[model samples]
Target: MKKLFTIFVAAAAISAAAHATTAFTDAKDAVDYRQSAFTMIRHNTGDIGEMLQGKVPFDAKRVQQRTDALAALAPLPWPAFSTPGTESGGGDAKPEIWADFKDFTAKADKFQLDAKALQTAAQSGDQAKIKAAFAAFRGNCKACHDKYKAD
Candidate 1:
């Protein structure tokens, strides 16, 4: 059952990430895709946070599954910001993303790295490492949001 669930989650994330490579019809389409991908990422990460916080029981298998899902999801949303009209596509994203495209891209790259690090930490079965990694992984959200996402 756990294996099946993990496979399902992974496949779904990959299938969704696959869309990031496709061309968007317009800025709205890109914004929609980006938002959807971020939402899914949040849901999985939130589950892991809940486990760590004791809001939910710690299930190592579930943590692994969520991290695996995150690995696949991490690359999905960043490309959408590069979609031509997304600069003007309305969402929580601010104009600064395009204004500071290099920095934004670098931060997005760091986010992917953080996601991979979280997966490694979870697999190591080290509680302290996993907690530290989880905190670091979450830092990417705030880092980007503070500068690029709207108030």
Candidate 2:
């Protein structure tokens, strides 16, 4: 029992140390992770948009799959605005993030709603409905990026 307790304590200390070291210390690291996630969502969303616009042939199965993927990406955790001496991948995040956190969160929630609506429209297979919802989805993207995202 004594030996087992000692081994457990050592393992716990190592795990804690690793976790502390892996925590993001700078805005850049956080932003990098966010950008990677965004890229994945963007790729999937763009594919859906193309199908919706009829620029690409519509594939219900593909649309459903991509829509599900994009919808899954909603409600990203808003990142901290700035850390001393930390750059956010040349990000255009204004200081307003901290100053206007409530507004930022609201927009994030709106994005989730818009994404869900788009997914529903795509699944419904109504061309007109998909077009309208896709436009709304695109508008939400622009609005959020305009206000919150860095250039």
Candidate 3:
């Protein structure tokens, strides 16, 4: 009976470990989640830029709405690459993400920082500050996409 109990415990432990390792079931799901998050970030940034540039009149309500959307997207839990049977599968993600993981993470971090700055500028309702922050935020996006997103 003790031996049987030990075997059951071992099985449970192994199962838990397997579940932990495969936090995402498939590569496509991972890619889709990432793309969705990026879309949110991009859309919000574009909206803010248009308002800042006077292409669209500043709408405080719309600015706050987009800012909240971006804040929600900022905390996405990106998966690690090459998980067993998983592959990036022609997504915009460049191979350098896995090849140079540290640099890739740095770029992502910079993007978040710039995004926060943009949000702050928007909140302040200062046109000049908004323009400057928008430029800074867009620059980070361009830098990262240039290196880490496939054309």
Task: Report the Cα lDDT for candidate 3.
Answer: 0.73
Q: State how far residue 126 of model 1 sits from its true place (Å).
A: 1.7
TM-score of each: 0.83, 0.72, 0.74
Winning candidate number (TM-score): 1
User: Which candidate's lDDT is highest?
Assistant: 1
Q: In model 2, which residue pairs have backbone atoms overlapping below 3 Å?
A: 92-150
lDDT, residue 47, model 1: 98
Using TM-score, rank the candidates from best to worst.
Answer: 1, 3, 2
- Local lDDT at 130 for model 2: 78
Q: What lDDT score is found at residue 136 in candidate 3?
A: 80
lDDT, candidate 3, at 125: 73
Residue-level lDDT of model 1, residues 1-151, one tens digit each, is 9999999999999988866655365688789889999999999999999999999999988999999999899999987888898878788989888888999999999999999999999999887898999999999999999998888
* C-alpha lDDT values of all predictions: 0.91, 0.72, 0.73
lDDT of candidate model 2 versus the reference: 0.72
User: Per-residue lDDT tens digits of candidate 3, residues 1-151?
Assistant: 9999999999999999776644266676567667777788888888887877789998877886787676667656355343433345446777777789798778777777776776787788777886787788788777877887888
